[model samples]
Target chain A: MLIEMLIDLTLACGVVLLSCLSLSAQRVFTAIVLYVSLGLLTTMIWARLNAWDVAIAEAAIGAGLTGALLLVAWRRLCDETAAQPEA
Target chain B: MFTKLEFRKREANRRELPPFAVYALGFVVIVLSVALMFSVVVSGKAAPKLAGLAAEKLEASGVENPVTAVLLNFRSYDTLLEIAVLLIVAIAVLPARSSNAAGVAHFCSADKQDVLNPVLAALLRWLVPLAILVGGYLLWTGAYSPGGAFQAGAVIAGAGVALSLAGRHEFLWHTTAARIVINLGLFVFIAVALSNALLTGTTLQYPVDYAGMLILVVEIAATVSIAAILLLLFTELKAMVDAPREGRQ
Candidate 1:
């Protein structure tokens, strides 16, 4: 019981820490990567709660698709023209 | 005219909070959180919890899985509206067809720039089939297990994403047939609801004898549409990446 409580405590703290770090990360790319890790951690939390259905959906949609979309959007926004000033 | 960076920097400086103000805000958050937790702990249940009630009715809910029963049979109206919202999003993101061609299919024509690396190509060859198989299994297992249309659809869409990354597969979302497939889930769901109303005098209330069959049919159609819509969202967003480059050149 103590070990289980410790594991749950660690997960909850990890989630809070990762979320703060992701929000305040200097680089957008690092923030997006951290955000994906946050999603995966939430998925684990959902599983630990015995919500298998929610866990699967979170892993697939929340973490996987959202992360992929964010990465692509970041790529598009940070393209050469966007980085360079007009002549 | 200010550059975006300069404008953003100015805005940031204007909006910057003093250290004391930041601490004040943090204090407010902590106090509110404590108050909320206190309310939750003090709350008494005036009404009996619904979990017991739901369990009692589970036998009549068509599916063995309570989650499936709730989603598809018990509160199907919410599910219906959710699908409609998804359809609206899918339509909003769909690219308008180019004038030269009837559809956006030509945009993804396998040019040299679209080629995949050999290792990724080999991985996709194995993974895509496995994903499809898993997706189908999830769909089928939803009736009795934790899997369902949303999970199955997401997995299938993941396969489509892998194919898009591989750069060899062509998505023909621009075609009439593809559009039909995309809308089929919502169309079928509404039809089922209306037909149930006609037959049973209540919309979306499946007759006990036919409940399982109706739910299964609706789930199958939903899985297909959900998968198609998700794949379309990914491909259209990816095409946006190439679109600005083309216009500039």
Candidate 2:
């Protein structure tokens, strides 16, 4: 029970930190990275909840696929931004 | 009067709090309130009947892994729908032509030196294959263990990403073969579902003798497709990085 509580607390702290970072991050890439970390933390929390299926899905689709998509989109946007001359 | 104007300007220059501050605070309050409500009103063992039914049905699936049984048999339709959703998302979010060009060029030429540090590359080379092996083992033993197709696919995709980053394969991102590999999973899934519907009068239902074989085939296809999609995404990002700098004076 003590271990479980510790795990829960750690996950909660991770979620809060990631959320704050996501909000404060200036670059789109940094935000995407934080979001992925949040997804990973959520997966750990799901694992602790004994919802192994949810945990696997969260890790694979949530963190892995979603993060990749966001990064690609961000990179594309960055390129577009660079191509436009400064006003 | 000039001093008063200067002071007013200084006060105006001091930044105001962002408009999102109020929304953020409200969101936190809503979440906390919801948590409190759940704690107060939600009962323990809320769905005992459904849980009991699930437990009773588990033995008939012939899978030792409860999660696997739930995913592959009991809630297989949901799994199928989820895969479909992923495929649809991939299709919908495919980069526009300029975006695609930008991504590919970025990947093909961008400063590899910064991203591909020697130590990290060596570490990845050592770790990636081991990760693949573990993922495969987890997938193969999923019927009797905690892991399954998604976990294995993600692991394999990680290896693919590592390989791409290490520059192990030039055509990893930009090839007809890559596109085919990515689509293969959806194709295989659809084919199986259609065949099962024809053969068994139900989509995705397999003959008792061939259940394990069917699952293995699906898992392999899923792993390949996932890896391809991930690698393709990375390649697209690389293209973006290399694109704008090409024509600059």
Candidate 3:
């Protein structure tokens, strides 16, 4: 019971820290990376709560696909800025 | 009066709040959130739980997994509407296709470039097929397990995303066949709902004898449609990324 409590505490703290860091990060790429890590932490929390289905969805969609999509979008934005310096 | 006006001008230009104000706002937010969480925790005891009710009728819902039973049977209208929303998003993001001589909407005449990265190519060669297999397994096992159409579809879309990132084979999303596949889930779901309404005089009420089979069929179609829609979102956005570059050149 103590061990489980410790695990839960760690996860909760990690989620709070990552979310704050991600929101405050100056760089968009860094923020996206941190957000993905936050997603992973929540996925683990879901698993610990015995919601296996939610864990899978969070890992696959929330973290993996969302991270990839954000990176691609960031890249696209960067390309646009590079192409149109005045805009 | 002149000094006061200057100070007001400076305040207008300031982009951030004073440190004390920031701290105060943060403190207020924290306190409110904690109070909200406390209320929810205390209220949960008084709230009537649906888990018991869902469990009682799980057998009639036609699936071994309670989650599946609820999502695909008991409250299937929500799922149907969710799929409709997905279809709308898919339609919104679908790339504009330029027609060729065949009169079929084809990929916009964007330049094709092979990925050239041998490692990525080799990785994809193994991973894509494996993803498809896993997606199929998830769909098949959902009736009795934690996996389902959404997870399976997301996995399959991940495979497509991987292929897109590698810049390998071009995915054709504009074809008539692809459109049908993308709409198949919502179409099949609505059809089933109407048929059930006709037979049982109530929509989404599955017959006990064939509930499993009907759920499986719906899941299969949903898996295909979800995968296609997600892949289309990625590919179309990716194409937009390329489109602007081509115009500039």
Q: What TM-scores does chain A show, candidate by candidate in order?
A: 0.92, 0.92, 0.93
lDDT of 2 by residue, B1-249 (tens): 111211122234334545588678789999999998798687655767866776787666657677777777667778777777766655643455533434353222434455566787778878878978977886888888778878787777767656655654443333455557768887888888899899999987776667767867877787667655665666556555555556565
lDDT of 3 at B130: 100
Whose TM-score is higher: candidate 1's or candidate 2's? Answer: 1
Please give the distance, in angstroms, between residue B186's alpha carbon in candidate 3 and its true position after superposition: 0.2
Q: Candidate 3, residues B1-249: lDDT per residue as tens digits?
A: 111211122335344687788789899999999999999898877644688888898889888898899899988889999999999999888767744436534532222564357887788889999999999998889999899999999999999888777765567777778889899999999999999999999999899999999999999999999988888888877777777778889
For candidate 1, the docking band is medium
Candidate 3: lDDT of B55?
87
Query: How do all the candidates rank in terms of TM-score, highest first?
Result: 1, 3, 2
Please list the residue runs of candidate 1 whose C-alpha ends up more than 4 Å from where it truly belongs after superposition: A80-83, B1-27, B44-48, B99-115, B246-249
User: lDDT per residue, candidate 3, A30-81, as tens digits?
Assistant: 9999999999999999999999999999998999888987887777767756
Error of 3 at B217 (Å): 0.5
Question: How much does each candidate deviate from the true structure in C-alpha RMSD?
Answer: 3.8, 8.5, 6.7
- True-structure lDDT of candidate 2: 0.70
